[model samples]
Target: MSDNQNLLAEQRRALILDEVRRRGGVRVNELTRKLNVSDMTVRRDLDALARQGVIEKVHGGAVPVVEASTHEPGFEAKSALELTAKEDIARAAAALVQPGSAIALSGGTTTFALAHHLVDVPELTVVTNSTRVADVFHTARQTAGAGGQRSGSPVVVLTGGVRTPSDSLVGPVADQAIRSLHFDVLFLGVHGISVEAGLSTPNIAEAETNRRFMRSARRVVVVADHTKWGTVGLSSFATLDAIDTLVTDSGLSEETRAEIAEHVPGLLVADRATSGSVPGNG
Candidate 1:
């Protein structure tokens, strides 16, 4: 009877895993209802799955584990994670942009979200290593001109380099291109940010390319969600002190925020917005 119960539990947990993956997240109550199991049982199963590193337990439920130091997810894979938090971070970072000033943007889903917010900035010049970032402006420009009207889109300069899994252009070519140009500010979206590792990435070449981006900018601002705080990637790119500001969402606890604030010059938190057009300022 014990062996049979164990087998049944395994099958039930397998269903839970599938549901989490399909919906990106699942609430405990919903799981209990779906599995016709007690709440405690569902919670126990979630604990077991979390311990296996297959799922991450959140406030009231579980979500797919998208965290890793050495393993980097592809652009589309990352695009689905923390979407609302990304938008919040993006709005906060976009507030730092000054019209007519040249700014550099490193590649990441957060930075891609920021690109959308910057499309209408007049006289802005955007220097980026992400093809997706550039395409945002390109699409905006085309749309504005569809009716034979002038568009106030920013001038986008896309760096030349090999593409990474995250849709970022990195390598000697990208580094050289960045070396020749300078920006008023750089909005960097990193794979991880820790007190020890600082800003880091799994790709060495991308790390080097990011370094160049930093060197060419007068100020550096990091945009990341709360989940990125404790993560440490394989390659360290910049120290915490090197960044001028950090923009994150309210999901971060006060204690963690206080601790991080001690290291960086400025820390800005974006409250979750009701819609995508959240307003923020530097």
Candidate 2:
């Protein structure tokens, strides 16, 4: 195929994957009409994606691979899911940050969202293991400088370590960096939060790095959406009592909320409407 044809084919496959992810499944005829491509072209794209394990090609179309709760999705995939809930949780988590306070943020999609919400807060010393979170601050600073103001940018320290599939920096390097720092608060984003397991993650290296983050901070605040309620990952980071507070969305069930409250009394369930206010205790 020509270079132009190959590029078009790649773009078509991306669109197909996105559609499947959004709708849970997609039909070949639907893709053909939407992408304005031939039926054979759609089939070929789906077949290629299926070979790569991105999707499962059924009789006519494709379906997203069902990832287990213990399995960690890539940054883009996780970011696309629970967007509104993550934003609401992030807004509530951002409210906890005081000006000139030093904070440590663990790497996760929810914490990444928190970084965007925190750009306006001046004089913050943010130490994080996520390169994406660091980039957010960097972009904010550049944008501010371009607009003739550079003083509002926070000091972002990106820890050096091995990058994970979720775009988190982990391993010994990250742990050592976090150990040298002390923060007012540590906002953690985990793969799962349960009354029994507390905070859990899929990767052992990330779990260890998160442990260092918790110890480096005076207070530990967990930022997670409702979907993380009962799902447990491969490794546990912190238990229930170790967390000072939890900022989550209102989509969490009342029964689960009540149960979690027993363990964490300072749970803040963020309402989706009106900038997410924290209801006293769950």
Candidate 3:
């Protein structure tokens, strides 16, 4: 094909993929009309993307690849899925924090919830990669000052790096920033956890950054809801034995709990009560 024709083809394919991502799926006829291309051309573009494994070609059209468990959802979407369970787990994890301690928290909705619970803890130095998590501590400091509370605010250190779809900063910048510091404990939020795969995340960059957090901390505490038990993501951050503790809600199955117990010696189940307090097995 001529250079001009090749450029046009590439642009058309880009548009088709973008449409498929935005709408979840797109018909060949729709792409033809939208891109002012022939039906055969649309089909050719779909076929090309399918060959690259970027999209799945269905009977009528194309859809994004089926990677539900490996797909990283945005903060709002994840926060809405397991509200109570995450909150309970966060409460349980927060109870492990001691005053005048330095802690590291990786990015995830569950760990973001844990940040809220740590607001009142005095004399804590928190290092995190989530912009939302940093904002939570920043707001708490502002609120405490407004109320004229004498207790010192928690120190928050936000690492800089490339932002992912989940609003986590990860990459070389974040890894370098964390290497110079040390934390007493590290609270990691993962997309999935299993006996075989251990703690995993959908984003490779986030996985690399999480490993740095583990290296900088003495104790590694994984905070995740029960839904994350069977799911496995694109990258595994830590093995079961490397984790010091696993904090999760009681919704985890008995069989799964038993299996996890064999790997994680310290597993805490957060049980929610009618009084709105979270109790942990500890």
RMSD of each candidate relative to the true structure: 9.4, 9.3, 13.6
* C-alpha positional error of residue 213 in candidate 2 after TM-score superposition, expressed in Å: 0.4
Between 1 and 2, whose TM-score is larger? 1
lDDT of 1 by residue, 1-282 (tens): 575586567557756776786578999999988889999999999998787666899999999887556798789978876666788788878888988899999999999999999988888989999999998988988887567424556888999999999999999999999999999999999998888899999999999999999999999999997767766788998999998888887656566677787788788887543433222223
Better of 2 and 3 by TM-score: 2
Tens digit of per-residue lDDT, candidate 2, span 164-188 = 9889999999989889899999999
Mark the regions of model 2 whose C-alpha exceeds 4 Å error after superposition: 1-70, 146-149, 280-282
Model 2, C-alpha of 66: deviation from truth (Å): 8.4
Candidate 2 colliding pairs: none
Top TM-score hit: 1
Candidate 2 — what's its lDDT? 0.83
Name the 10 consecutive residues with the lowest summed lDDT in model 2. 6-15
Task: Give me the runs in candidate 1 sitting further than 4 Å from their true place.
Answer: 1-68, 147-151, 273-282
- Candidate 1 clash figure, as a count: 0
Ranking by lDDT: 1, 2, 3
Better of 1 and 2 by lDDT: 1
TM-score of each model, in listed order: 0.76, 0.75, 0.73
**Against the true structure, whose lDDT is highest?**
1
A best-first ranking of the candidates according to their TM-score comes to 1, 2, 3
